[model samples]
Target: MSKQKTQPSMIGRMLRHLAGTHAVARRAFPSATLKAIQAGIGEGEKQHRAQVRMIVETSLSLGAVWRGESSRQRAHELFSRYRIWDTEENCGVLVYVNLADHKVEIVADRGVSRVVTRQQWQDVCRAMTAGYAHGAYHESTLQALEQLHVLLAGAMPRDSGDTAGANELSDKPLIL
Candidate 1:
């Protein structure tokens, strides 16, 4: 699992340890912003069969810290916990953001992976994190959702007969 900044300095780590708490995430991406993100997900899914989930976490748990958990590792755990890999078409994707580290991790299901390469996902993650570097959280997230929509629409267009496409997963962005 590759990280954005592989070797953060001791002081940077210490500051991030304090700055990236859950409380901070809530403040950064509050209930209203989260709702907007959920809406964006819903809008994006209308044109395709792909399932998209956005998850933002304020910081790592003490246990995770002791376990040496990285953002990429936590994204995998969240992927399973939220069942992002369990969609009907295996086209679910999770856009995970670790607020403290200002890191973004994009995990796609096997079906989506067939069309979208890991390098593409990494590019999107980097783009999203770049926005965060400028404190443009909402703009970055919305843009990422848009990117997912375009990619998924091209990869997995909606079935014509499926009028009332079901939402296999909640559109609500998980704030951890």
Candidate 2:
């Protein structure tokens, strides 16, 4: 018979950790901003799908595959830092939380470090530490995530909802 591995129980500890994370995320963002972020994510996805359709149309009109490929390359280069994906890669940090382990980690990319400054990170960390102590870290993390989403949404195209129809030609290829 094969032996089954059992997980350890830390229900009380997990609750305490979750409470702390919540507090920290909340402190990082405003309530209105959080709603906006959730809405933006939905809108952005719609826009991205339209942009893909635009590319398909543009490819056919431009003739040769090479031309289409070059255009795509140029488009990517032009908006590399102007979209959410680029923002995440270039100027964002990952906040990790482990309720079971009662641990929190924030990893920032080089771009984020360059733009946010050391003092800012320190301040955020200090606030998070306080939240952890008070069992509000979970909330704090949620707030921070909401704020980050809004910041990232700044990179989305202004008319992101306009989908590219089969017969329509994009004025500017919907760059970023």
Candidate 3:
């Protein structure tokens, strides 16, 4: 009898989610890395008025996986839940990393979407994912942040003496 390779079953996805615990997330993003990411976000914000938030999730909930929630969908949910879209210029960006699904999603607010093309955002995600595939998590994140900063600076440069456009979102990177 010949054995055929098939797509991963729902049970298999659930098992993958169960294996991707908080411990795995912690291992991937330790305290020092998180601090660096936070600092990177702050530095990036200084170059532009846009708010950048990074979220690294080890896995989706069993229910989420069962419902076939995509990484992009989860990223949009987080973007909303965390109020990334509430920035002054409406140029907030969310970088979501799902380890279990091996996916990277970049969700940009409408203001940014107007200036930055989807292909540009996808390129950023692909670069980050490439670094992640090689276990260069910290380096990859910082590089992606730099790329985002450039994009935001081009799209919405911080105006001189515009104090009202101050930091509107948390600088801390969320690990879930």
The lDDT of each candidate is 0.83, 0.37, 0.88
Q: For candidate 1, give the lDDT.
A: 0.83
- The reply for model 2, stretches above 4 Å from the true place, is 1-89, 98-103, 146-176
Root-mean-square deviation of every model: 3.7, 17.4, 2.6
Query: How far off is model 2, as Cα RMSD?
Result: 17.4
TM-score of 3: 0.91
Minimal lDDT window, size 10, model 3: 1-10
Clashing pairs in 1: none
Tens digits of per-residue lDDT, candidate 3, 1-176, equal: 12222235666778889999899888888999999999999988888878888889999998899888989999999999999999877888998999998899999899889988999888889888899999988899889888988988888888888655678788899988
| RMSD (CA, angstroms), candidate 1 | 3.7
Ranking by TM-score: 3, 1, 2
Please give the lDDT score at residue 129 for candidate 2. 48
Better of 1 and 2 by TM-score: 1
Give lDDT tens digits, candidate 1, residues 35-143. 8899999988998998898888887865676567888999999999989999888988999988877789998899998988888788788778888888888888888
By lDDT, highest first, what's the ranking?
Answer: 3, 1, 2
| Deviating ranges (above 4 Å) for candidate 3 | 1-9, 163-165
Q: lDDT of candidate 3 vs native?
A: 0.88
